[model samples]
Each structure stands twice: as structure tokens, then as C-alpha cells.
Target: MATSSDRHRIRFTVHYDGRSFHGWQVQPDQRTAQGELERVLAKLTNGPCAVIGSGRTDRGVHATGQVAAADVPLRWSPHALRRAMNALLPDDVWVADAEMAPPFFHPRYDATSRSYIYRLGLASEADSPFRAPWCWPLLRPVDLLAMERAAERIVGDHSFKAFAKAGQEERGDRCTVTEARWAPWEGIGLEFHVSANRFLHHMVRYLVGTLVDIGLGQREPEEMDRLLAGEEGLETSPPAPAEGLFLTAVTYPADAGTKPPRRRGPQLVP
Candidate 1:
């Protein structure tokens, strides 16, 4: 339970299937996760409600633990508001949980780290209709050792300019990658898990594409070193298919939903 305050901030988690929506952000004449949420919330709040998400996932990128925040009228408790919104939202999106957040909670600003997992399937059955929507079906084995070696370089702070899409350098292309690793999935090819303070547009997909190519022996593993050098002359492979990407979690300051002036620990690690 949250005590009364000058402002009422609501924090919520959502899990959405991105196939039917344009992306996380609202766009003109587009179906988006944020748009759907704001619309339903506005109806419930009986006013214009703005829902701010932790990140802007690309089109067709799913999220199992997307975090967001909003300000609603003081009359509504967190549980009631969550139920109301869930009742009105479409089937593709589900409000996993909601809570009364502290007045100062801002979804994006208060987040300390975000984690994403990219799934790939190597078996011929990976291309099955049932599996294609969730994972990349390569249908052929890739060199896991090579990919792991390349991923090791991703740890630590560095300029990810090469892995991100262009036109974003205006915001400066840098991210602190605390963890980047590859692991075998349940009878699937592998899943790439990368946790970072922040990610640039298409950075994860591009890194996956390049790493896959390295596994295929199309590129050298040291290319990651050159790309992070922040100099020209190296380019990453095409971005991986968006369907394989899932935003697994967003790590916020522990005190994010408690009150104003959120307290944060060091970025997530280990």
C-alpha cells in the first residue's frame, strides 16, 4: 500500500506480442503498445493520460517485462487501476502487474539497466510454422565458439557506433554493456543475453547479425574490437530479424516506485 501524496504515479508491467503492433512508441495512424495503453488509461482516468515506457522496442520486437509509468487520479488504487486497464486492453497485450509508484518515478530516467534475449533455432524444425514467430530459424548450425569469443569483447563501456543504426549519433552512440554472453537453449540453437545500462537503436540485432556471421566464419572475431574503436572502416552485418528479440526485463532503481528522488544502485551485473 502507498501513502497519500501530492501526485499519484502508477507503475505497471506489460507483456505484449509485437506482431500486431507497429512498435512500442506511438505513431500517427499506427497501432502501438503505448497508444493502446494510453487510450485505455485515458478512458479509465477520464482524462488525457500519458504512459511512458522504459524503452522503444522496434517493430515486431516482443517484451515479456516492459515497464512503464503514468499519473492517474488519486481516487484509484494501483490494483483497481490495473484491473480496469486490463479489462479494456486488447488480447495481444496484457498488464502483468501494477502498483502505486512514488511521485517522482519516471520509467526511462529511473531505469538502471535493461536486458534482452535473442533466440535462434538451428534445427530444420526451427522453421516450423509454430516456432518461426518466436525465434530465428537458421536451420543450420553456427560456430558457437566463435560467437562466444566475439561476445566476450562486448563487456565493459565502449562506443557501439558500429552495431547501431545510423541517424542516432545525434544522441551519441555509447552504451555500458555489463554482460554479453551466449548459451544453449532448450533444444534450440542458442540465446544471446546482453544486459546493459542502455542500448542504441538496433544495437542488439546488429550485434547478433555480426556475431552470427562470425560463427559462420564470414567475419573475424576481432572485428568487434575494431568496431568499438570508434573509427571508420568496419561495418556490422544486417540487423537480425526482429521476431527473435524479446525484452526480458528492465532494472530500475530499487526505490523507483517508492517515492520521489529515486535511489539507485550501480547498474546490474553478475
Candidate 2:
């Protein structure tokens, strides 16, 4: 139990390659971001500490701007915490920044929006070995214009029940998607950017799969409205590969910080 005087809140950011991790949350017998972080925090503070993340990411999901918060009795400078944690965490996970936050602040509840980026390579050759672990490589050609048109259909608030995966029936399927678009990137790749108040499990990937189907002529763009309108008979889309997915950014109230820190190399844990 926490005593009144033991209350101390800290905020931090983490970057991780989800390919090597089981997921962000700690699980029994699985190496996860939360487990690694808690281990380091316990060693540093010489006691148990609970770390709360802004969101839960699935296996093989990557995050460049994941945020978490924890309460601990030990008081260490943010730089020190950053250095110490980086040393203890594995090379695949890096601590970007750590700072004090209002005691009432909670990473999950305080977040205003979250952004995700999905990359699709439009080339006949396989992706380079170095980039293979972080991107989805496609050899088949994709119709870029068709993908963009289908993507536009998902913008705005709607009941996304059809897009949601099975076993999420208890939670309503309404989601307010503020932005959804795909744009050509440099060379032979395209990027899909989506921002929302909240997301259903595998929502972005499902959307990507749906649009990719449209690009491939497997489905008509007009089918999107029926899908959104709770129509049945439309086939479920396949989730885009996890490697190309990244949790890019999370927004909070302005007072949380004017800007997030720049990405840097991993620090050594104490």
C-alpha cells in the first residue's frame, strides 16, 4: 500500500521494436516491456513499483512514442532515471525521457489522441535485411489511387463493429477517427496515418487490410459505407503485417509539455 508521503509521480517515453518483444504489458513467463521496466525500477528504487502505460500494444507491434507513468518513493533526476533504465533495459527497448508529473496525472487517462503509422512498400524485390524487421515488404503492385480513395471513407465518427475483431463484443464498437489518409512516401512506399480518440484492438491494421483489398480489386470502395453501417456479408479483411506498424505519437494537454524529446541512442542502466 502507498503512504501519503510516498506518493511521487514520474512520466517517461519509450521506443521499442515490437518484433522482438511479446508485447508492452507484462505477462506471466513472457518478456515484455512492462516486465523489463518494472525489473529496472525495482532495482533502482530497492522496492516494488507499478508502471502504467498509456496503451496496450499487441505482439510484434512497435512504438516510437509510447508513454508510461509510475509512482515511487525514490526521487531521482529525470536524466538519472533515463540513464539508469537504459542500462537495465534490453537493447531493443530504449528510454527516451523521464520527468516529474502532477500526482493526479495518469498516462492512459490523460492522453487526448494517439497516432499510428503503417508503411507499405511498393516494390517487386524483398525489403533490405536491415529494414525487414521494421517494415512490411510487398512484391505485388498496389493501386495507390484506389487505396487513398478507400482510406478516405473511414474518416470521422462511426460504428466500426465490422472492423473490430472477435471477442470484443462487451465493449461498444463506436470510435471517433479524426484523421485517416494514405500518402506516397519517398521511393516505392506509402504511409498510412491515423489519429483517433481511442482505438479498438487491431483497428488500424484491419483498416489497412481493408484498403489494401480495395487497392487489389478484391473489394469495392463503396463497400466501406455498408461495412461502417453494420451491414453483414462483407468479408473480413486481413490485418497488415505488424512489422510496418508503429505507434508514432500521443497527444496530451498543452501543459503536459511543449514538445517531446528527440530520439537518441539507448542509455546504460546503473
Candidate 3:
């Protein structure tokens, strides 16, 4: 049991635009989600605080359900912590919700799966300044059927070495893709949705770029198989732009931690 002054865990979900910020992780003199959150938390806790994140989202990648955990004073209720933290955070970043977690809880290692979505703007209207921040506007139409077929091939356990960036192979490139699909986006374009046990660096963006290439007839759909098989020396298309990607959710087993804390606004469900 925690004493009155003892430190326990607090888990929170943060939403960020990622357009102006450097990324999720902290870097010296760089504006980042984690950096800002840690700053405010340190002030609130009245000392140094290390905020651990579910993972590092690349620069320009947005997230609606990015999970992070930190130890704070035992008296800081999840609701009060969120309200206080949001008061000091900039408009681009906000704590959507928070929960009290076990001392052993770790956002990244405890996650059962992580989900991401890539939005493609197929319609010409996407060029509007208002719509440019969250989507990739394609100037030319591509075959949606081909993209769907390629997405189907991605639903399984695979090495994915070819899809990841160089040096990511040190941890091994295997990922178990439990769910993967392409769906229409409100009659405007298509979006790729995928959930995996783990992801290698830049794997999803690479997959999206490769699938888009196949849709444009730049490569055969069968190339997905070769990539999964870790075929050496076959290069992939350039990664999809970071703005098109969003971390939609993260899942954890019920036993992984404690019940979610109460909140005042619409909760960010994971």
C-alpha cells in the first residue's frame, strides 16, 4: 500500500495535432508532446518527473489516443491531475483522460495491441487549406480494389524486415498483425486500419506507401508477399507522409492494470 507521501502511477491519454511539435519524445530545445507534458508534470509534482510513453510517434504524426504513464503524488486524483495539467499545457496538446494505474504498469510493455490509421485524400477538395493538416491528398486516383487486396495480405504474423527502416532489425522485425483492412472514408477516399502486437519503426508508413504503389500500378500486388518473406535487396516505395498517419488506439488486457479514473469530458476510449 502507498503511504500518504508515497508515489504511485498515473496513466493518461494525450491528443496532439503534431503539425508544429517535433514529435512524441523529448529533445533538447525541441517542442514535443512528451517534453511539454513532462514540464507541466514536473511543476505540478514540484520535482523532476519522467513521463514514459507507449511509444515514440515520428515527427508530424498525430495521435488521439497516445498513452503515457508517470509516478505522481498519491493524493493527485486522476481527474484533478488531468484538469491541472491541461491548464498549463499549450493548445496543441491536451490530456484527454487519465486513470490511476498500478505501480508496475508500463504503457508500452503492458499494451496488448496498438492500432493506427492512415488517411488518404482522394477527392480534389482535399487541397483546401483546412483539410491539408490531417490527410495525404493524392493528385491522382488509384485503384481501391488493389489496395484492399494488398491490405488483406498484411493480416498475419510476418518478419516485415523489408518494411522497416534500417537498423530496426536489431530487435527483430517480426510483428503479429491481428487486424488489417482498408475502408472507405466518408465517400471522400480510403483509409488503412491496422492493429498489431508490435510495430517496427516506420513499418506502417512503408506498408501504406507500398500498397499505394500497387494501387497505382507501380508495383504488383504480389510484392507484399515478397516483402513479408524478407526478400533481400528489393526496395520499397518511399514511406507515406507522416501527416496521414494517426495513432487511433492502444489495447491492454483487463488484468494489466487498474480501473480507469473518472473524467469530466468525453473520454478517449482505447
Candidate 4:
């Protein structure tokens, strides 16, 4: 029978360079965030262990505050486990912090919201190798006001079907977005910050793509509203490059919560 003495749950705050991973979810023969964690954990425990993440980030999508949970043998305290994992983990994946969690903790289901940041390079300097991999180097000015207006339209509850990948309709596409805004990035570009109760596949990317079009004057800002309303024949713009997206944080209820860090200017990708 399972008992507290048998295994303990640990919550982990992780960061990773998405360029090196296939994605967050584990797949047969694919290198993924979860797969790496499980592999390391299995070696530590001398058996299989599963790691559950707050959500699945697509390929080439980075993360600074991704949360995950897993069960480890009772001998491995949170601190020791974290230290051990870091010692064995690869350079691109890191365990920023680890703590005790209730045995019932489930990162994905317990999360109250998730936040993402998408970076865009509006200047020629952004083309530098160091920055280009982390942002879309458009090398042109965009109408910030137009993008802001379009973002405002998504700041409340809405059916985001048009902005998501199809085939998940059974779960519905309604998302309650609490915040969405554009901010100046580290003097090189613009960044979009968005927080929501839930996100559908490619929702943020589609939103960014569509908003970028509006900012570029290729579409009207009002089109955001039309997409939310699911106007017939109206489709979202192509998804933005996955390289520019980052899973910034995940939030949960007060007792189980990990509040997001103070909002700041976008930081350089490590």
C-alpha cells in the first residue's frame, strides 16, 4: 500500500533552452523536457519515475518559470533531490527551485493561470546571433498603438477558437485572459505579455501573428474582435515563430500558489 513513507511529492521550478528540446511532453524516442526529467529521476531512484509539467510547450518554445511535479523515494528530500538533479541534468535544462508538495498535487490541473512572453526585434541589431534565436527580427517598426488596441480585445473571457489549433474542440476553447499587453523589450525590440486561465494549442502564437499584421497595417485592429466572435471565413494569421515564445510562469490558488515574479523588462535569454 502507498504511504507517506513510501514516496514524497516534490514541486520543481524549471527553466530550459527550448532550442535543445523537442518540446515539454514525452514521446517515443524523442528528447523532451519530461523525458529528460524522467530519465534522470529513474537513474536516481533505480526505477521509472514520471514528471508532470504545468503544460506542454511546443518545440522551440523556451521557459523561465515552468512548474512540474514528481514523486521520489522518501530518502530524497526536496533540497537533496534538487541538488542531485542539477548535478546530473544537462546544461540547457535547469532546476531553479524545488519544494515539498502535497501528494495529490497535479501541476497542470491545479494551475489557475499561465503566462507567456513573445519577443519581436524591431531593430537591425536584433539580427545578432545572440538575440536572433530568441526573437523574431522583423527589423522594421510596428504600430505599437494598433497592437495594443488589438491586445485589449483579448483581456477578458472569450472563445478563442479562431486563435487555436483545431481538433481540441471537445475541451472547448474559451479562455479567461486576465492580462495582455505590449512592453518595450531590452531596447532591442517589443515583447508581449499575456496571462490567462488556460490556453489552447498555438493560441498565443496565433494572437501574436494576427496582432503583428494589424501593427504592420496589413489588417485592421477590429479584426481581433471579429476573430473572437468567430466570424465565418475569418481565420487567424499564421502562428508566430515558436523560437520567440517563452512560458514565463504558472499560477495556482492561494494555498498552493506560486505567484509570478514582478513584471520587468524582458531579460536576455541565458
The lDDT values for all models are 0.86, 0.80, 0.85, 0.88
Write out the backbone clash pairs for model 3. Answer: none
Off by over 4 Å in 2: 1-4, 124-126, 255-270
| C-alpha RMSD in Å of predicted model 4 compared with the true structure | 6.8
lDDT of 4 by residue, 1-270 (tens): 112567877899999989978999988988898789888999999988878899999999999999998878889999999999999999989999999876556687778999999999998889999999999898988999999999999999999999989888998989999999999999999999999999999999999999999999999999999999999999988999999999999998755524333333211110
**Least accurate 10 contiguous residues by lDDT in model 1:** 261-270
Judging by lDDT, tell me the better candidate of 1 and 4.
4
Off by over 4 Å in 4: 1-4, 257-270
Please state the error at residue 215 of candidate 1 in Å.
1.0
lDDT of 3 by residue, 1-270 (tens): 211247778899989999988889889999999999989988998987888888889999999999998888887999999999999999999899998887566687678899999988898767668776888998579988888888889998888888888988578878999988888887768889999999988999999999999999999888888888868888888999999899989998877645433323211111
Model 4 / residue 59 / CA error / Å: 0.9
Query: In model 3, how many backbone clashes occur?
Result: 0
Worst lDDT 10-window in candidate 4:
261-270
Show where candidate 1 strays beyond 4 Å.
1-7, 257-270
lDDT of 1 by residue, 197-254 (tens): 9999999999999999999899999988988896576688899999999999999767
Compared to the true structure, candidate 4 yields what TM-score?
A: 0.92
Q: Model 2 misses residue 196 by how many Å?
A: 0.3
Better of 1 and 2 by lDDT: 1
What's the distance in Å from true for residue 201, model 1?
A: 0.8
Query: Which residue pairs clash in candidate 1?
Result: none
Better of 1 and 3 by lDDT: 1
Residue runs of model 3 more than 4 Å from their true location after superposition: 1-5, 257-270
CA error at residue 237 for candidate 2, angstroms: 1.3
